[model samples]
Target: MNPTDLSLDDLDRAEAEIETGKRGMRFDQIGSFEPNAPSFLIQDVLERDSQAGVIGDSGSGKTFAVLSLAACIATGKPFAGHSVAHSGPVLYAAGEGRAGLVRRFHAWAKANGVDPLNVPLYLADRGAGLIDADQIAELRAAVRKVAQLHGVPVILIVDTWARALSGADENSAADAGQAIAVLDELRREYGGMTTLVIHHLGAADKTRGRGSTALKAALDSEFLVARNQSSTILLTATKTKDGPTPAPMAFELEDVFLKTLEDGRKVSSAWARPVEYVAESRPAGKNQSVALEVLKQLYAAQKQTLDGAGFAGREALVLVSDWRQACEAAGLDRRRFSEVKASLVDSGKVFLEGPHALLDADAVSGAASESGGTIVPPGRRTHSAMSEIGVSDAFGHFGQNPKGGR
Candidate 1:
């Protein structure tokens, strides 16, 4: 049809064709690669236009971790030493109880010294299913309205993927991919925004999310939240698409007092707080290696005993005599054993209290200890091997009765 003689229908068809062509880019039209913002939503942890999957066992503190992240992003503050590049309004769609989430948020804020009322953070009125197109659209509309009201870009955080799925088959690749697609769509519609989905870990592996592998493959990053032997929450980046994985962080759950009820009863909830990090000590030589093996054995036994008896944190203790027995069983030379024991003590891995020794529960792995505190054999303050067979076996074999010390 001639341009001037074209009917309305012909013009509409032409416009549709032109738009379709625009969707496909030519090789020359594609620009050269450039880095995304150096620090994004949560610095190296989360980037703009990205989605991350965080999974953990029940009570592993995944929800708290995400909440903390949302608060940091909303205020553009540093989270556990990591910077936040994009600070804006955060929308938390609680798949669980709204009241409970609010209480937890208050507790976290109080514990971290952040004023919750001052931050531009909002909680969704209710949860929406991810697979339903209508629900997704409705959520987007609600989020957009809220974002506009707050005068900030929206960073949507879905509390739990399973709750959003509404009993859909998470194992099915199609179902999982569709859920992830919904998250991506939200990201794209919100001006390259970030979305974080809390998930559950597989019962077997406990490393990745408990769903179709596609759910993991589709994510820009994946984090595993777990409680270590010391009952500390450990957050590790299992996978990162673009940025380098940051070091693992350890946190202790601290209870924040909320308020008193009419009956004069107090209430409180837990918040994740960063703990002091302590690096593992290394063996200096063959003698030290044997001593370390002994320490490991004794500590394992001590921890097992404490756990079996329902003890945790500072309440747990291991007798010094046990360490001495472990030393004897391992056939560690007396002089070398003393040096290794002193090193472990000086390193803060093993705390000495009277006639007992226990592992430092508050110490986080990968943290460096104070320098210039080398444990030298009593006589040999210097590096010389004062290998006298029994020249003051500093950790003398103090009787063999475990109950005696306890």
Candidate 2:
């Protein structure tokens, strides 16, 4: 048979028919590779054949952010200011059950003028357990069935990674590694498939993923959805294998009125929208408000300009030393002030540049998020081994800098 005369379908059939003794691809078959092997699923952010994570505290809008991305891929709409390079079917497994997810998607469709029945988006309210062979089989079977009906799904999103674990200690590398392996296997079963799992943040520090280091090790991309000063959330690409991580980006979740019940009650859900960078802000917390007041006093006396590409536009910039002195003079302990300062920098509410700090203009007031729900950090020692992990890992950047760029 002439290789040049064979169609891809024919080549696939030939490859399948090959005997067990002939395991690998023939040299001539190299030309048959998928032309878009690693094409972007979300332009400049995510790619095919990869696994990624969107991690945050509770009610931080991580769910809304990811759902919006999935909707964009399903309907070929740009997400958070980035165009979709490739769009297709999506399988979203809701580990927390069908509760708010369905409404959220409907809200997305309604807001985007898309008929829910038209797109190849499938949802399973109950997600599969990573360590459960039976559930894994069932999930894969469902994916295959969806492919038979619609086209192969471009991405599979697991809502909450912890909820999907059964009879496995998430902190154990062996268990976490095994679960991750199963996900990787499932991802590879379909060509050009993306497995993006949603995870949670550590409790005490409110930094890094909640579970084992192994989970982060397997991720090809990682995005952090955090509350900014303007009552909006910042969806940042913390790690990207293909290129340098993009600059700081932000978005807001707007409430969408889904429908009215027969009883005259109105139903509503929130959907994410690409809003211009609102200075990567965050509203002040109880402790932060005091530090903020001190900064303001110093600013009233004198202020400096932090001119740069990523610095929050002309805002209240003050010397870190002066602010600390003011805080100390006001009965704020040095130790306590350090923690407060770290919190601000870590959350992007305060940007540090060469001993100077710039406070986000909108970081003065508001709730934790648009949902008005704050995430209570959980200490997952067995699950989180970040204490032993370095600041920088092979998988991605672990730096705590809240600047817009790397």
Top of the candidates by TM-score: 2
List pairs with backbone clashes in candidate 2: 203-378, 211-383, 228-281, 228-282, 229-281, 229-282, 229-283
> Tens-digit lDDT track for model 2 on 154-259?
9999878887776888788888887888888877778888999998987743545776888877788888778855668777655555443444566678789987
* Native-structure RMSD, model 1: 16.4
**TM accuracy, model 1:** 0.63
lDDT of 1: 0.65
Question: Model 2 clash tally?
Answer: 7
lDDT of each: 0.65, 0.68
* Candidate 2 segments exceeding 4 Å error: 1-19, 22-38, 280-406
lDDT for model 2 comes to 0.68
Q: Give lDDT tens digits, candidate 1, residues 193-225.
A: 778888897765454578788877887777777
